[model samples]
Target: MARFRSICNTLEVLFFLIFSAWSLGNRGSEAKDTLLAGEKLRDGENLVSAHKLFEVKFINLENSQNRYLAILYLFGYDGRAVWIANRDNPLMDSSGVLSINRKGNLVLTSGKGNSTIINSEEPAMGGNTSATILDSGNLILRDGERILWQSSDYLSDYTLYLQNDTTLGTETTREKGRQLLDFGHSAKRKLWLQITVLVLIIMSAFLIAFIICRLKSRYCDSGGNNEKNEENDTASSRLQLNKFSDIEAAYKNNNASEQKLCGNKDSELPLFSFSSIESATNNFSTTNKLGEGGFGPVYKGKLVGGQEIAVKRLSKMSRQGLEQFKNEFTLICKLQHRNLVRLLGCCIEGDELILIYEYMPNKGLDSFLFDPMKRALLDWRTRVSIIEGIAQGLLYLHKYSRLKIIHRDLKTSNVLLDCDMNPKISDFGTARVFGQNESQANTSRIIGTFGYMSPEYAMDGLFSEKSDVFSFGVMMLEIVSGRKNNGFYQTDSDLNLLGYAWDLRNQEKILELMDSTLVDSCSTNEFEFIRYVHVGFLCVQQSAADRPTMSEVVSMLSNETTSLPSPKQPAFTIGKSNIGVESSLSTGQESVNDVTISVMNGR
Candidate 1:
């Protein structure tokens, strides 16, 4: 008896310690918090987590406004949010408080003494409810044994980013009152009309039912059974049909439309909801804003399934109108080359037109090439590779793609970097497509970056394949020498990067113009790099006819046997042009506006 009493006492103490630890964890005192910038809720108080990694509090969300509660994580990392004593009634101010009641049932009461039951083991005298977060990321509330509401069944824009293998399953179609029927056939030598008229009546009924369903389907919306009739539903459906008809009519009206922009009506396109994008971006928080441009502000967003995407939201106030936007959207969808930026998809929701793209982690080339410390990462080998990559991409866009495209705007800021340090030419807002037979085209409105723009295009709006070549040449020089073509040499000389390169090439001191970051890594291959510089100078010639074709440029870069011709002095007297034109196109246009973006924690 004495030995048994000692063993029982030891067991009781162990149970007590376990209960104590669990109680402490339930209070949410131990979990670490990453208080991000822009999550300003209260003055000092914010979300608190349980050390057990089970619960997160600060209960205010899109629907849970001005409410706070203690929740449990039934699974490892999932938050139950089971105990919201104030469900129907919420506090107007921050006066609402939640605490463990005397019975260990978490309770919440309003300042007006109105308490709403969140979860209870037993149903109220007249009502029934029980709430729990399941391991599959499903928050469920039950009335008796049957579920009254569940998070798994009802989907919203935002979802908790809990760490779990919980996956959204494939969606199934819902039908109204449809059942299977078995067919019976009777074989008799004599004409066997069923003696029982009831069975014949049932067969006739099925035929009538099938005919009615077929009739209903003919008039119904063609986008499956997703159609629901509301006040504006009819008008919206008409508009969609009208849009489709217009596309068809456009093809019929313009015989050349097939060759024109945005002609591929058969291409499979991705469709995403506006609400989904808004939720993914946390309603476009200021933190996720990446960069801004003339077209719109670009934002960083993560999808619910953890796919990172960049969204470009076009501003309504911008000089470019809907037509320009359409042209850009159309050109990008059809133009696919290894060197060109890939267009993943686009979203057109009301006035909110957004283009979704594969997120480039390293951002634009300007970010690193211009930064003092970051530039160190771009060694000679990397720089050389980048130059080669850009060249390859341009070659594809110029010669390999279905249509010959002239990228009117090919500046350092538009060159995007992939994960492997590969370069991709992006931003097709100013691109123009030309046929193989068509040589030159002129536009009254001259639109291009000032420093990168060829002299002929800048003055008389004469642009062809050569305009992009000029920009590429200027960019090559900028890459070789860590200096902006337009901004460098502002003091005594009006000479730009082209003029400087011309002078250096003439004096045979071209090696001095190389970026210092390349000096150590390029110790052995300096000669090859010098030859590339000489090639770059040759491409940026004064006349369009004098400039080498992209194909010729590639051949010169690859062939060691091909002797390169000496380049003439480039035209550098652009300061005398209209000062207003220079200021408007150079400073005003290049300086894109800023935008605010949202970043959700634990994405």
Candidate 2:
């Protein structure tokens, strides 16, 4: 009996030791909740939320071999993907990895070695950065407690269905209750039917009220004064006749221009009634006004369906007349590019002329580029992106688009930013279309921001693709230096931003022209910084022939191996004498002469 008891004790001890070892091994190999810097989440591996509600891993869609890094729900839905990292550029094979790079960017690399930065704005470097899949199904990259990027901010097309009870058993039970489910579905159908009937009844009531109001007005007109009503009717008929005549003439001209350019009869531009615009803008409320440009006051408006828009109303006192309005309407209707602002429709009633566009929430690039506080938000990466976007936009206009267009008013204020900080070139009122063989054109009326105009265009009224290149270069310098070219005079040398950049380049101290806020963000990428400045110099060369074309500019920006040619001295490097003359004129005023010039100041 004593030997048997001893044997039992030994077996119990051995079992306890084996169980402890097994638990330790499982704990070490279990799925992690966060991915740290330098640690990669491989194709087969995943990071799960704390409560195991969400998971982030590599996935392939149905019947598609291409793989994507996505965040998905873990329970009740069998891993339905909520957000995808590389939706547009999916991996060809299953070999994929996601990690936080040294620069604090969340990057996804595919089997072919292509990388995509998931973060919109590169986070500032510091601390141990990590990525976590939250219980809310949001994949977030964080530096300690501060979130550097979140998947919620950038939603995908996939809809996420949230459930109060997230359990497999509950889902199974619900699935089994088919009769109850059918009854609930029937209840919903009945509810919808009732709502539809209610809506119809309400609509009928409105129609009846409208008819009664019309009858009342007619009865009053019949009883009050027949002779007065006749005179009023005659005057109203004449006014309407003139209005219709003007509209018909405008339509005919626009149709002819559209036929010559687009040749698509079905691509008709929508015409909004003036009353609808007034209602959208709340009768042009002072609070709804965005700002007054050279043309007129712009207002922020929302349509009945919750679509936000920007309404550009032409002022009677504006220097831009009917010809300019018509020119803008006809030209913009035919041109379509991702970088160009989208014109929703237009309104022409009586003397009122308005153009409606998709509202840009972030407003103009100048609003952020020149603002002291907002400029800091635009780091080196974002500025480079903006520069590249604008370059592509110009390249499309100068080469790729159906109709070659010259954005005569390319300035900081004319470049608008979307919610994602993507740059869209706006203000096509001064833009001109170029023929297939036409290289340059001369115009007596010079309409553009003073600092942005090229020397050839400013002096001899000769404008071409090179002229736009000059303007782009000036803008590049401004974007890099975070300073406006116009009205920017150095106290000592009386030099503007352009001349200062040139003088710095001569001294081989061009890095000093960089924005102070960019120092930390671009410390490791000094070569890229200098390269951009060099390209800016190349674009702003004095001679139009010396400047690179938009295509070459884009190539130089995109390809690192493309060698750039030496740039000559830039034009209009105004000194103290010139500054005095420029300062004397009122800002935002047109030159009162045969050579009409609209001067735009830095706002």
Candidate number with greatest lDDT? 2
lDDT of 1 by residue, 18-135 (tens): 3443353255544333222123223124333323322334465346456654333433224434333344555666655443233323344455564534343544232333344332
lDDT of 2 by residue, 1-603 (tens): 222222333343334433432332234324577899989988999998655656898888766899888877654447767567787788998778888888778888876895855763656456588887755566777665445676753211111111122542245544544554476568747755775575566556556665665675677677875657655765766654543344445554443223222212223466799989999999999999998766788999999899999999988766474446666786777565678787887887666888899999999998999999999999999999999999988988887564589988798888999999999998888889887568999876667767888877766678999988999999999999999888788999989888889999999999999999999999998999999999999998889999999989988998989898888888767655675434533344563321235743222
Q: How much does each candidate deviate from the true structure in C-alpha RMSD?
A: 28.9, 22.0
The 0-to-1 C-alpha lDDT of every candidate, in the order given, reads: 0.59, 0.73
Candidate 2 lowest-lDDT run of ten: 155-164
Which 10 consecutive residues of model 1 have the lowest summed lDDT?
173-182
Q: Indicate the residue-level lDDT of 572 in model 1.
A: 52
